[model samples]
Target: MTGRRGPTLLSLGLNRARDTVTAQTPVTDLDEQTARDELARLAKVLGGANAAYHTSDDPVISDADYDALKRRNSEIEAQFPGLKRKDSPSEQVGATPSEGFSKVTHAVPMLSLANAFDDTDVVEFDGRIRKYLGLDGAAALSYTAEPKIDGLSLSLRYEKGELVQAATRGDGTVGENVTANARTIHNVPQSLNGAPDVLEVRGEVYMSHPDFEALNARQAEAGQKQFANPRNAAAGSLRQLDATITRARPLEFFAYAWGALSEPLAETQMGAIERLNALGFQTNPLTIICDSPEAMVAHYRDIEQQRASLGYDIDGVVYKVNDLGLQGRLGFRSTTPRWAIAHKFPAELAWTRLDSIDIQVGRTGALSPVARLAPVTVGGVVVSNATLHNEDYIAGRDNKGDEIREGKDIRVGDWVQVYRAGDVIPKVADVDLSKRSKDAPVFEMPHSCPQCGSDAVREPGDAVRRCTGGLICPAQAVEKLKHFVSRSAFDIDGLGAKQVEQFYADGWIAEPADIFELRAKYGSGVQQLKNREGWGDKSASNLFDAIDDRRNIPLNRVIFALGIRHVGDAAANLLALHYATWDAFSAAMRTAQEGNPAWNDLLSIDGVGAVMATSLATTFNQAAEIASIDRLVAHLDIQTAARPDTAGSPVAGKTVVFTGTLEKMTRAEAKARAEALGAKVSGSVSAKTDILVAGPGAGSKAKKAVELGIETLDEDAWLELIAPL
Candidate 1:
């Protein structure tokens, strides 16, 4: 074996004796000890390499070295049953499950792709497709080759023209419902132009290079944790609980396929992409129409050579049967479409030394451990750090308390396996135990906050360690300030990350109060702000106008604009409705913080918890902060809440469900129109539903309407119902 041996003999759980040497040199020559050692070594190597590639946008290892190690790890696991670890590199999928988003079941399944590892695989795939279509070799067959976006796969459902739902590819059967979050993405149209009456378009939502860079820069400046790669950033952005938050994140969508459509698309794959583009959907621009698989291979080579120049991440090229009819004939097998195959670009891997481990605190106060590595590149990005996740992750320990790889430790200067997939954060997939330095030191998390030296306490039953410094901490303060000026917050124009940092550094603006005061010193005191290199007279006026325009912001915007921890847009809206005004809300928070009689009442709110209440109270308690708010109010106008229109309404508070395809208006328009007429638009049809607006090809919702005995209206009837009054 080329790696360290496992620990002293332990019970194998089977009826095997101690020192039980295999009579035939083991069924698989790689024993459990050897497998564990090799697996760990490979993981460390891959993990470190991935971190370098993503964080720095520079690659270190060649594609071949990474693939060989990955394949070897897979082989070893197959040969050694006892050595497989839960956190083993071989078991990792793409990224961790996104947080803060409600899980949704996809209406149409998002299928996985079949792979084409070599020319032979491509030829065999073509042969199978032709065989299924009963076509001879002489018959001309074409394929569409597109860059396989190695990012999260999602389906956007639209009725009429309005987007209603977005789902992840959860097991290909169901996925998380991230409709609100998906709507926030600018590239993801809320209402499509000339869209199909009903369409479920499948796309790979990714982060562009520019956006990813901006996001990371902001993270670094704020001293908050940064994503390892663009894919991770996109995934995290898309999975936010608040659609507003997701919307604020720089997310882009590229349509790749269709899920469920009311009407047939084009005759060929290329035609479908064109049709998608015409419908105002952002289709992958790299799609090429090829005469044969050879042409596809050529295109793949060209793409591989141009990979560095591409703005978005790509793992390989996907070759699909061009003819729609032929694709149908080819059908599907298991989780993949038989008519299509993804010819993956060779894996990008590299070698780097693990320098140290650092702990990062998230917005929610959960502490996460990250590995600092010698800067290197595995893919296109330069990765200096990789996620260690938690203490359990670092110890090579499993759920059962069994020491993984015989208690092998990941230490400083250890060569590690680094893997990257699209925008997913790079992770330490394995450790190269064979190359472990004798002088390498075991890694340990700090006992105190790395930034503020506050006691980092691990909450009971939690995996993360959090700083006790609260608002006073520099990292937290900077991040909170940034969040306050975010799009979902005050949304002040010209107060982007760079501008905010510049103003903060110059002491021109320390808090929100300083923003309103800028106009007060418009001429001399703040002359530099106007004459700043990027801030000309026109730009300065625009910034001031934007700020002035939002002076009298809505209650919900005010609440969210405060940047309270864990208080997202939805929570802010709920709080606004409960309190109705700033004074009442501030009083309530004070009472809750002081543990007064109203404290329980505060917690009684649906989503309010101890942490949220504490955060709210802490924010309101600061005199300077409160004074800043007063100053802001002096120059601002507060808008009153809009009253719901209910006069002479036919369906006031009536539960209505919409189904099928509508021709005249987009589903969003229809829903808004219905809501305006005092009806509540719901996703599913229930007994409580009074009316079901059925379009032309109504699906399950219509069926449910019949079962529930709800009155149904077709597209024309729905238009008639709302047209009169």
Candidate 2:
């Protein structure tokens, strides 16, 4: 049958016979037509699975099977081009790159919910809803009160019952295409069980409590950095470049709203939620139907009381108008909805003793005082310390000149109110005078640095004191080294926090210069590194290679890695663009300290304030610090500055913004290629923008560019402009 028919039969998971009508016919025999039919069926099933994996956070098929089936379908399509279908899995890009998260004009604008701060606000919301619907005060409205999840907002698009696109809520109008990462989430459905032909569902992508704990445990065990909170963890995980990595992490999703849809359900909003639930999507169970704003406020109180008990993280309760018709009438603001409001829960608070006041030296030598509190759990994490901010914050009193917390001062043995602001860091909200002991000593700012005992003084008009000892300060040195090798900083592979600490403890490294000299001192000549526990020949070699690979670093990255005070990535990039070379930057810093106008100009750069400028100047002014930097420079090879291509380059060094749909390549791809060729890509078109790459359906960005008189190019014209260069 194989020779008589063709490869189609053989490729359809069937055994073939050499001769045509044989006595022993294959039991799994499939004719040409049957094979084609079966192949299409299999493709559809696999595609559905792929969509499930991508659209819904949960996956039903194994990775091995998915890969094999995809490969088989590819082979079939290659052999039978005419048989190829429009929705072939082979044609789809498996994952979207995270770089350059361009704006996606939402089919239906994603509006934010109005916020209700208190019970009064809730009552007002209820009155407005009833007034709009022409309902009597006595008319009760059913409401579904649910915990408002604190996580990343996403929109999933489905076409013909299959998931097509998933996007982040970037600036409302645009968002990063995180479809691949979103697929890894188990709760996000790849294909609806009984989905509509076209549907767009909005959901909150979160990391559950148990999953968050396990993730943090793994992070701790692996010695990798841990997330500050679950919301941050979920956001960071969903934005990962590799979707498979996202799949490995614990992520959850709950459908809360809808965008563009082809059909309508019952008149009420609750009916639409029920429909979503029937479609196998996970919706928050806490949702309640309330008839009036008074009932909504009651529901908010109930949810707030159960906030700690709920396994998932929720910042507040979302109250939406039940009737769809009324909702349409209510309308919306620029970025938020008018028909709904978010009722926030009261802040979590705890009382603890102020054991002591200690100063911590940061990487920038800023001495920040911390209130050492008795161990207490304010939100979830244990609170042992709270930021005192500065001397003024500690000394200032109420308008009456009495102590703020009932005449109590921040001192040892004084009870302090520890409050978790937005579930982040615990801060000393107030001091309790009634509980303050007679022996409670008044706290005073330290005269010397806690780490190095260098003269610590508060500068004029500055609230916080700073350590003058730059490189000699132990705390600052350790933090600076850690920051230099952090993932977002230099990204020096194999040189994580543990390794840095180990190297520092071993007396092998004291400054950044010592890192580049590790291979020279411990390479083939020494066996110490290999003999050390957890270190092997292969690991050592890999580490050495990773270290070597980072020798030629980008100027912007190098600037960031220097651990300069208040100099983040954006500031570093700005500095690199302005200076263009390390020597130029160094010279500028020195001249700035010497009162040069150019130095003052550097200080005048946006986001670079007088304090940051002073710190930068102070860092380079000392001869010892300069000598140490020179030594570090001697041990490392400075990367050559990339010269902007001036020959036939119309867009080189020009700032460009892209908007709408492109025909030749994806917006992400275009932006990446343009950046590689030495063009700056800005999210918004401003006066500094030189060119605007407008595609079909260009929106406000293009309009702004035109208004500013910036040159504009269409998709084809953009391709043409870059083609000559």
- How well is each residue in 620-662 modelled by candidate 2, as lDDT tens digits? 8878778877877675666656656666677777888886545
Off by over 4 Å in 2: 1-136, 139-292, 295-299, 302-360, 368-448, 461-463, 487-490, 520-526, 552-557, 566-618, 652-686, 692-720
- What lDDT would candidate 2 get against the real structure? 0.70
TM-score, cand. 2 vs. native = 0.50
Q: Candidates' TM-scores?
A: 0.47, 0.50
How good is model 1 by TM-score?
A: 0.47
Query: Over 4 Å off in model 1, which ranges?
Result: 1-342, 345-442, 461-463, 521-526, 593-635, 647-725
Native RMSD of candidate 1 (Å): 22.4
Q: What is the lDDT of residue 6 in candidate 2?
A: 16
lDDT of 1 by residue, 490-597 (tens): 888877777777777676776676777777765533356666777776787888777777777887788887777679876886687667777677677766644576
Prediction RMSDs, each to the true structure: 22.4, 18.4
Q: How does residue 501 of candidate 2 score in lDDT?
A: 81
